[model samples]
Structures are given as C-alpha cells and as structure tokens.
Target: MNDHSTNKPIDESWVAHLRDLSTGVEPPTSANPHAMSRVAIRRTRTRRAVLTTGGGVLTVAAVAGAAFAIGSPTTSGPLLPGAPTSASADPSMSAEERRAREVEAAAVRALESGNVPAGWHVNVLEGLVYALPPEIVTSGPVQDEPGVTSDMWHSSEDPDSPPFLRMAYVTPDYEFYDTKASGLTQTPGPDARSFDLPGASVATVDDSAPLSEIAGAPEADPDRGLVKILVHREDGPGRYMITMNLGTADPEFVEGFLTTLTLS
Candidate 1:
C-alpha cells in the first residue's frame, strides 16, 4: 500500500516544514494556535498608541501658539476723530476762570459781528475797541497837553454832570504815573485790586480822590466818585487810562463796562 493516504500536498505543507527545519524541531500544531494572532494584536496596539500620541502633541502645540498670540503686548492705535486731547482734556476750572473765558469769548463774538446796540457807538482807537453807552454823548477830543490824546463822553441830559467817561492814550514820552507812585493819599475805601482781562493788565482804583488827581489832571472833582482803570497794553509801548465818574451811574455798571474792553 502507498503512504500517500496519510500525507498532505507539498504546496500547503511546505511552510510548516520550513519552520521546523529552521528550528530543528517539529512544527507546532493545534496546541499553540494563537501565536500569530498575539503578534498582530500587539502591532495594532502600538500603531494606535503612536497615532494618539502624535494627535495630542499637535493639539498642545496649537494651544501654545494661541496663548502666545493673546498674551503679547501691542502698541496703541490712533485716537478717534474729533477726540479732545492735551490741555482741553482737563475739565476742572474754577468758577471765576470759567466766567472769564465766557466773557472773553462773548467779546470776540461781538467784535466779529460788528453790531453795536441802538443809540450806542463803538470807538476804535489807540489799538483798542470799546462800546459807549447810549446815555453818553461823545464829544470831540478834549484840548489836552502834548503827547496826550483823549476822548471825552458827557451825559446828554445834564450840562454840568460831574460824572463822565474819559479814555486817554498817552505817548511813551509822557511820564507813566500810577497811584502806587503818585504819593497822593487815598481815602479809606476799597483798596486797589487787579482784574483779569484777555491780553491786558488791568487794575481798579476805588480811592476817595477823583481819578483825575491820580492822572495828574489840573482839576479834581471832589464831589464825583471815580472808577479808574489802568490798562497795560499787550501789543505796543503805551498804556490806556480809563476813568468813569460814578456820578454817571452805579459803580458796578462802570466795572462791567471796563471788563468789556478788548484789545484790537
């Protein structure tokens, strides 16, 4: 009988025969069948672990990039249009300062408009512009000494009114004298005080003696109260002396008018 009944074909049995020949042992059978399956399972697990680790590393790198971008300091951008900056940004101003600004602005607006009140006239002379009240009549320049030019305003109603307004422009050669240096004694009253005027230095004299005395006038009206203002010019070499006799009206009204004077 042939041994072919128990033998397998060579094509299917050669792998086991080769394995046994290499190892010098008989090939394994059904007793150890899962050896190849365990190797395949370990390979699959290792590949999955590598892919998961790579994905985690990529996620960490992306997060770090985003954090750096967010935490970096940046330069400031331009301000919005029409935004107030510098000195104007400060809003705290005293009431007196605010009033002064408002008055100055109003005077500017008035000068731009060029509209004087009815029956009132605006005199522009000696590098200045000021308004005269309706009740005062402007006479021609008073006959005064050399180097001194003056415009006199008298009350329209009273021929011999003691109260009047006098504005004088003095030349550089004319001696500049003030109450502080006149050596004339002042009657006990409100002391001399300085005031705020745009582009001018102004002082108020409320002494008992008439302003004419301090201004070296030949005549002094003791019965007339005077509101004398010494205005230091901002643009030129001369000063303006404004005197308003209180016989015209209230002293407060005269003060208000003096405050309205603006430099040309």
Candidate 2:
C-alpha cells in the first residue's frame, strides 16, 4: 500500500524544472529603485492639459472684450444732439464751453430733445395712472412730485424696450383720471388707467399722498430675469425714479441695471 502522509522520495527532475522557472523572473536591481514611474508620468500629463485649457479660455475672453470696445461708437470732434453739423453753426461759444454744452445736452438728450429722439428705439409709453401723495414724490435730483406723474425715461438703453423716449409730469391731488401721458399729470383721459404698487409707504415715497402718476412698464416679463421693474419715491429733488423696467430683449443678455437706491 502507498503511504500518502509520509514523505515520498523527492523528484529531483521536477525540482530542477521549478528552479529554472524561478531563474526566469527578473528582480529589481540598483539601476531601477523606484518601481511605479508610470503613474507619475500620467499625472504630469494631466496637469499640463489642464493648464493649456485654462489659457485658451482666458484668451477667448480677452478677444471678446477688445471686439466690444472697437465696435461701439467713438468721436473726438463733437457730441451728438448738441453740436451742429456745420462749422459756422454756433461760433460764439469757446471749444471748452461747446464741449460742456455738448456733454450736458447729451446727458439730458430727451428733455434737450424736447421731443423723443428718432430711430434710437421705443418701448410702449403704456398709459397707467396711480394715486400718490404730494408729500411722497418729487422731481429734482430725486423726489419732486408724485401722483400726477408722467412717463420718465430713466433706464438702461435697449432696442426692444418701451417708450425709448420718456417724459415725466406731476399729477394734482383730489381726483383720479385717465389719459395719455404726454407728460406726468393726473388728467385722466379715456386711454389712461391707474397703476398698483403693493404696500408702498410714505416715508420711502417722500411725496404727498392721494397724488396721481403715470409710467410705462413694457410687455416683457420682469420676474423671469434677475432684472426687475423699479418704481419708487425718494426724498432728494430732481431725481426720483417713478418706474423702471429692466431686462434684455436677448434671453442671454438679461441683467439688472441699477446699483443703488435712496428714499431721502
């Protein structure tokens, strides 16, 4: 009987075969101490790719900025809506005075225009009247008069906006009316109607109460964009904003315009 547990005579030929296999396996020598060099190379390549992509993005942004600057209008001779086309138009004022007048005229192009400028653009001067107090609205620098108000064109310019040309007028107290807003007034005609500004208060409005006003809010939806329609009364004179609608006609360009507001 063959004994399974007891040690059998060793096969010297098989042992020789195993030793040959072991000899075929190469071991790391002093020449190549670090075993995992492939991983490091891959990491280096990834870092280089990321840096290259970042540089390309910055280059594109710079190019776009340059293009915008170049395409916009530029003139050193005279400002629009002020300087006449002919050299002999107004030879009385000095160049400095002419420049100052040009700037000032450009700043108030609408009132200076006396009529809305042509071809720039126009949004609806939709007629909407509302009640306000005399103490809550004013027009100089901020709040001057409220209630009997008219369309005020104080907004960021856009081609699709309403009433590109705007004018504001003060409405009188004691009665509500409806009509076209040629200028701010409470004289309501068949076309005009009152507006609703929810929960507006007197401290912020700064004008007298029970006053009437009119303004234009374009047809675009303000809530969708971060852009909002701003209408409020402030304490300052000559500059109170009655209403503002902000947005982009382009879906991609929609954004808010004003940076600050004050009631006093």
Candidate 3:
C-alpha cells in the first residue's frame, strides 16, 4: 500500500512508474530503435496532464465544497429553515430502511435486556464469534473472507443518534483491501438495493477508491477512507472484526472498540 501520509499530487513520473508496473513494460533504452517505451512514456504523461488538470482536479474541488457544506453548524442538526415546520416530525422511511431499523432496534433491546436469542446470530461456522462490551460489539472471520456481520449501538454523544458497523473479512483478492475511497460519486450497481441508513458513513464498508488502478487481492490500510476496520487481517489468523458507527467518525474510538473483540 502507498504511504497514507503521501501528499504529493502523484506526478507524471509516479504515474509512469505505476503504468509500467501494471503493463509489464520496461523503461526506454537508447540502443533500441523502436520508441515503444518512449511512446508509452509520452502517452502516459500527456494523459496525466490532461486528466489531472482538466477533470480530476475539478471533481476534487466539488467534493471539497460538499465537505465544507457538511461541516457547517447549520448542518449539524435540524432541517434548513423554511423547508417545513414538520420536516422535523419523523422523516418517512423506505421499506428497506424500516426493516433495517427494526432489526437494529431488536439488537439494542436484546443487548440491553440481556436475552439476545442465540438465533439472532447465525452460526455460520464454529470459529466465528462475537462479544459486546459497554462501548462496542465485534465479530468476524475465523479465516479470510469471513461472512458479513452488521451490528450497531445508540450513539453515546447523542441519544437520538444510532450507528453501526458492517464488518467483512477480506482476502488479498478483494479490490478494497488497502485503498482509500476517492469519494462517493460512483453510482451503486444496477441491481443495487436502496436504504436510508440511520447514522454516519463509516469511511469504507467494502468499497474502494473511485479510480483505484488496483486489481485483485490488494492489501489495505484500515484507516484508508475507512471509519472503522472491516477486519484486522494483517493480525493474521484468528482475527475478528468490530465496527463503531454509533458516533462521530473517530479513528481512535474505532481502535478502542476493536480492543474489546473476543474469540468466544
């Protein structure tokens, strides 16, 4: 994985290096009459200039604008003025959203009431496990590509808020293993089902950056566009997962939550 701290604009030279890596080409040699390497080098650099300044930078500008808007105090809560007085009166729910809410609520009740039916958790495989501490609940793979686990809790900072984590173990073969999501402009696939999830987005939940040239089985950084880790695969065997979506996106909190995961 590239350094998370790298702030460079990913210049033409870097892009050329990346391209050479992807296509299995060698750099130009003076003795070679054919300019194939030279041609490739030229084309990649030209494409870099055009793509970066013309479209990529502009798209980045728009996302920055949205981030600014979302950070404003007015957006912290409550609908904008003049939208409607009752706009605060319970927004309508999509069917999928309603179903998810019911499920989450049941989970909360089970945790609080201390009687989460065993059936609430599917026993996919024997080694899979979960545990809930005061701050978080976590469960994931006994091995790579473990099945998905989604769990949530009411937000501590805001009683009205609720957040959850969606955990999935990754093999080196998954596209999103170690990249930050570019942003959320890419449309969901054609068969995508919709839902109005109740709380914040947790950086990455099984996703990759918009144009990551990475192909199959890439490794990933847990903090790369990810609010919470899907799993700690590099922790090696017996790794499980926990996601913390119940509050503001804090990487520390997510790590703290991970500390509570247990194999039982």
Candidate 4:
C-alpha cells in the first residue's frame, strides 16, 4: 500500500496529527466502519440509476501520453481526444461544478502516474482510474452528488450487453459512525470479505448486482454474479465502490484488472 509508486509507506500517525491540528479535535473512535445509512443507500441507488440510463451532466477529457503502473508490462500512448483541460479554477462555476472538475482532474493525474498494458483502454472518471480491454467502451464522471461521481463500461457495439463494470467515488460528508441509523454496517453474509489496499483504513468485498440491473433491466445472464469492492480513505473522508459484474468475464481477470485501479 505505497502511495502511487513512491514506495514510501503512508504515515498514519502524522496524518492523524495533522487532522487533529486542523480540526482542533480528534475524529470519533467509535465510528462503525460498516453501517449504511438510509441517505447512503439512496445515494448509491441514484448513482446506479444514472449509470444504467447513461443520463447525466457528462464531461469528457482527452489524456495524451498518460502513464500508469501495474504488475503487468505497460506501454505509453495517447488516448482518445474528448476531455478538455481541468477548469476547477473557472470563477463562474458553482462550488459543486468546481469540485467535480477537480475530481476528474485527479483521476487523470492518477492514470498519468502509472502504466498500463499496450492494448488496454484506460478509463479516468469520477476520481476512479482503471483500464478496460480494447473491446470495451466507458463513459462518465457523472456528477451524482456535489462530490460523488460514477462511470460505466461495457463491450462495444453490443447494445444488448449490460455494463459489466461501474465505479463511483463518494466524498465523506459526515464523521464515521457505526450505528445502524447513521453509518454503514458490514455487508452481510459469509461471502463478504476484506482486502488490503493502499491508503485505506477499510476495504471490503461482497456480492452485488450490476448497477444497470439494479436500476431496472434484467441482466442477460441470470447466473452472472457481480462483486462490489468498498474502499474507505485512511487519511480523509472519501470512499470508492467498484462493481465488477461477472458476465462472460473470468473472475481471475476481473481481480487482476482491479489491481490497476487508482483512486484519489
């Protein structure tokens, strides 16, 4: 869990000290890492619905010569041209619009800091970074909330194929709590598990349905299973949820692909 190939371990104590110094108080120690509030559930549902319908305020950026690192060999190349320069500094934009722009820029920076396989198409959206096979197309940075964004991807030219992957980033708006009414409870069931990710205090994985399916349309394959990975920031208030809807994809491939994901 090194910071973006720095090979330097994150200083948790120093980070905590800084938080305390800035806030003049310590974060709550009793925050439950698992409880899901009604607001949170509703937020999640709204995000998925937007992804499913491919409807939202969309912004695209073209990242040329962006690089990223992964366990596999990688190559550097120009990506499709679409996105404009990050304009969070635009004086006319609302605070929410500025936040969304900043998140998208951070996502691009994350990709540029690493490398990817030669044939892969890198996706930078909503402060989440990952790569897809050449056959898949991705879209978004959909501003679900003031600070939350989502992206959806699926095979190209196949309108019938459901989006096999969706990713979202939620900026923490409240202090962490474990109570049933205000925080997240661990995703129930024996299949739920935890992961060790960089710069995260808690990372959990569990079964889920594709956001598209959750929105309404039934998946083409009833037997297909999707897995959701939730990662909570260690140094700040933010979290990322990545859904891999296992359709015709191999589970191992999905796991390996996730290794390339970068979040800010």
Candidate 5:
C-alpha cells in the first residue's frame, strides 16, 4: 500500500475542479496559486447579481455599487428614491439638519415619481407627503401628544380669509379624531356620506357639523359653512381628517382639490 499522507501537496485536480464549479472561467495561462485565486475571485464577482425596485424603477446593484435601471438608457445614477445624489456631507451640518434635508429630497423624488404637476407645494409631516396646489398654502404641522395638525388656506392678499382646510394626521395607535386631552371633537356624525378617492380605501364627507366644532377656529364662517372629509389609507393602518370650508362653491370643489393630492 502507498503511504500518501506524509509530505503530500494539495491535489491539483481537486483545486481545478473547485475553481471550475465555483466560477466557470478559464484559468490564467501563468497559473500560479495567487493568479488562479485572483481569476476565481474576479469570475465570481462578475457572475453575481442583486436586484431591487423603487417607484417603478428596477435597479440592479452590482460590483462596486454600480447600478442600472431597466427600460431606460444606461447612465450611472442612483435610481432609488431618497438616495443622496452627493456622497459628501458637510462637517458643520448637524444630524437634525441633515435628516431634514434628506427627507425633503426624498419627498421631492417621490413627487416626481408620482408625476405631480408643477406649481405645487409639498409638506412632509410624520413621514407622509402632502402635495398641494400653489393656490392652497399650508401652515403649522403643530405637534402635540394627540397628533399633528396642518392647516391649509387659499393664497390671498387678505389675511382675514378663512382657512379652507384643517388636516389632522393622527398617531398610529389613535383614531382620526380621538376624544383625548387635545380637546379636539370627533364630529363626523353617522350621517356623513362615504365616497372614494385614490390612495384611500374609505372616505367620508360631512357638511352637517359646524366649523367651530370641527377645529375650533376663530374665523369660522357660519353662513358659508364647511365640509369634513375623513380618509383611511388604503395600504396601511392610518386615518387622516380634512375639514374643507366651502366658500362660494359646492362639495365638488373639495373633491377636485383632493384629486391633485399625491400622498405616499
């Protein structure tokens, strides 16, 4: 019997088989151990792939972080929404400021992906994007324990004009209009009419409640009146309430405003 264990070199045939199985590429002609290892590494990387998608853009993040999108001409740019266009971060910028800028950029990318029209103002509050028309100005994402409120108004020369909309994006654990310490009344009565809107599964409109009872506004117009619309998010556990003041028009105007909204 032949004793092969003492002073035996690695079997060359076994190494060649492993190299062929792991990576199907011809080895270098100058097949030193180091050169063969390099060839295997290179071939393995070239054959590997990872795929991801965002906002209808399919991206393949491959070797050295190079990405390419499908159905589009190849140009090397980050296809993911909210991906930083520039890698360099300012040394003086605080973490909060950087986060704010990142969120803003992400919202902009989202709006573009949604094809929101020009002349629209976007408000990002509590990670939700609210895109409004130029005619509709928004204010105060006033944060409290109950929820966050963002009031909308018609862009006018007169400051006395009553706000057209009051939005409340409630906390995840709470209802749209929770009867809590915020003192905000939950006023969408049983008589509220239900309707449909994109990105929302359930929507309701109630014109019966007084504006004062809706948001406790000092500028509530008793005669012109207002309408309350509550929307339930289609894909998630979230509810948002929008109280719209019907100035000179009907409830249809509110619906028209809602069509322009891009929520993500």
Candidate 6:
C-alpha cells in the first residue's frame, strides 16, 4: 500500500530482512547473565499457562479519560512528582534509574487524564494501561522473561498469523538500555525510505523478495505480508517496545493507531 500523505509506496524488503534476522540469530541472551535463567523459566511457564487457559482476553473499562482492566482494577489516584531530567543532567544517577523516573512521570500524566481514544481498547495490568486497536485479539499480558510484561494481539480469525501489534513493557530492574541498544544497532540500509510521525522514528522498505522464513506463505500477499513497525520509548518508570505488523501495508492505519497510544 502507498502512503498518500507522502506519495511513496511502503517498502517490504525490510520486513523480509527482519524475518531473516529473527531466524538467523540465536535467541536473545540478556546482558545480565544472572537473570537469563530466571527469564527463561518464567517465559516457559507463562507460555504453558496461556496455552492451557486458551488465552484470556482482557476486558477494559473506560472511565473519564483513563482505561482500566475489569479484572485488574487500578485507582485513578494522583501520581507522585519529582522525576529527574535527562541522563546528562543527572551525572550521579544510572541510566536505568533516569529512564525509570521518566517512565513514571509519563504514566502519571496518562493516569491523570484517564483518556481512551475512540475505537481502541485498554489492556490494564500491573498498574499500567495501554491503548490498542479493537481488531486485534490478545491473551491479556504475557511474560517476556523476568521483569518484562508483554501483550500480543493478532487477528482473531487466525491466531497463528502474524500479529497486528505487540507491546512489551520492561520494568526498572530490567536492563532496558541494553535492549534498546541492541535494536538500534540493526539500522536499515540507505535504500530504505523513511517517514515522519509524531513522537516516533519511521522507515519503510519494499522490494521483490522471496519469503524464505515462513513455508507455504506467498512471497508477498496484497492483503497480508511482512510489515514491521518498531517503536521504542522510555518513560517515567519503564521502557516500552511497541511493534505493528500490518497486513494491508496501510501507513495511515499505523499512524492512527499510534496516535491513540496513552500509557497510564
């Protein structure tokens, strides 16, 4: 699909490149060796539980401007202030601490507003709320290793298909700097086109490439192929990784979806 706003066609080459990257590299090994085993164990356990439970879809309740999970209720209480400025400003504090403070501040602002955008649902868990599109289906919050909470949403008609969206929130104790650093290192080549978005960095790649990662899948389907949008942000007390895998290649839809994002 083309981005009418920019009059440029969406790129598909990077999607294939990403699939190759996912398969080519070994499973990610955390920078902290001591936490690796625990993360693995927790991930395995969570996966098994989700499979056995048939995946629980979280129900959200919109109150004023905030969204709250029906099962995991959160109070619309005032947030504490006093978050530090940027890392450069705080020489005595560690990177993780500074990021945590920023995340906390963002969360507070989100909670204070309690606003849920139109046509989106909120997945509230562990004192955090995320606004997401209604077309996507998820099994509440999935654990992506220790200190990391992940929520994945895919087409309800085909759970095995590529996900429409995935949000991973990393807690303060986890090493978010290393995680973000690893992703930043995988920069796209000069051929990839870039786009502008509020509060985000965007890029696109399209080419006639074979699909070697998924068997029996078409090289590129008009309605469904590989469209990966990676958005990473560190706010008040956490680090968020939001990914959008669209089947229609509609950049407008991606942009609209992102505009609705609110973290409380």
Cα RMSD to the true fold for all candidates: 17.2, 23.1, 37.4, 40.3, 19.7, 44.9
| TM agreement with the true structure for every prediction | 0.46, 0.22, 0.23, 0.45, 0.47, 0.38
TM-score computed on alpha carbons, candidate 5: 0.47
> Cα lDDT of all candidates, in order?
0.62, 0.37, 0.41, 0.59, 0.59, 0.51
User: Model 3: per-residue lDDT, tens digit, 1-264?
Assistant: 775875857588888888888788768756764678898899999999998889988897787788677553224477777865432244565666765655555445434544333333322112223333343323333344333223334434554444454444433344434444343222242332232212212212333332122211123533333332333322343222333334333544444333333222
lDDT of 1 by residue, 1-264 (tens): 665566655785788788878887657666454888898899999999998999889987787787567653232465578964443333467666866665566556655655444445566546556776777788665897665677888787884664577787766655543334353321223566666667765544554454546544434555455566667676665667766765633765665565456675
Per-residue lDDT value at 66 in model 6? 50
Candidate 6 or 3, higher lDDT: 6
Clashing pairs in 1: none
Residues 1-264, candidate 6: write the lDDT tens digits.
875575667579988888888887787665986688899999999998886565332223234225233322244443347843334433678877866766666655644555545666655433344556676788565657776777778877787765556656656566553343422212343444444433434333321122213223365565543443333332344455454555545755655544445434
How far residue 165's Cα lies from its native spot in candidate 4, in Å, is 1.9
Query: How big is the positional error of residue 137 in model 5, measured in Å on the Cα after superposition?
Result: 2.6
> By descending lDDT, how would the candidates be arranged?
1, 4, 5, 6, 3, 2
Best by TM-score: 5
- Native-structure RMSD, model 5: 19.7
- True lDDT of residue 118, candidate 1: 41
> Of 2 and 4, which scores higher on TM-score?
4
Q: How accurate is candidate 3 locally (lDDT)?
A: 0.41
Which parts of model 1 are misplaced by more than 4 Å?
1-119, 176-190, 203-224
Predicted candidate 4 versus true structure: per-residue lDDT over 73-109, tens digit per residue: 1323433488443342234689887777676676566
Question: Could you tell me how far off, in angstroms, the CA of residue 123 lies in candidate 4 after the best superposition?
Answer: 3.2
What are the per-residue Cα lDDT tens digits for candidate 5 across 191-217?
Answer: 678765667777677765344454554
Candidate 5 collision pairs: none
**Pick by lDDT: 2 or 6, better one:** 6
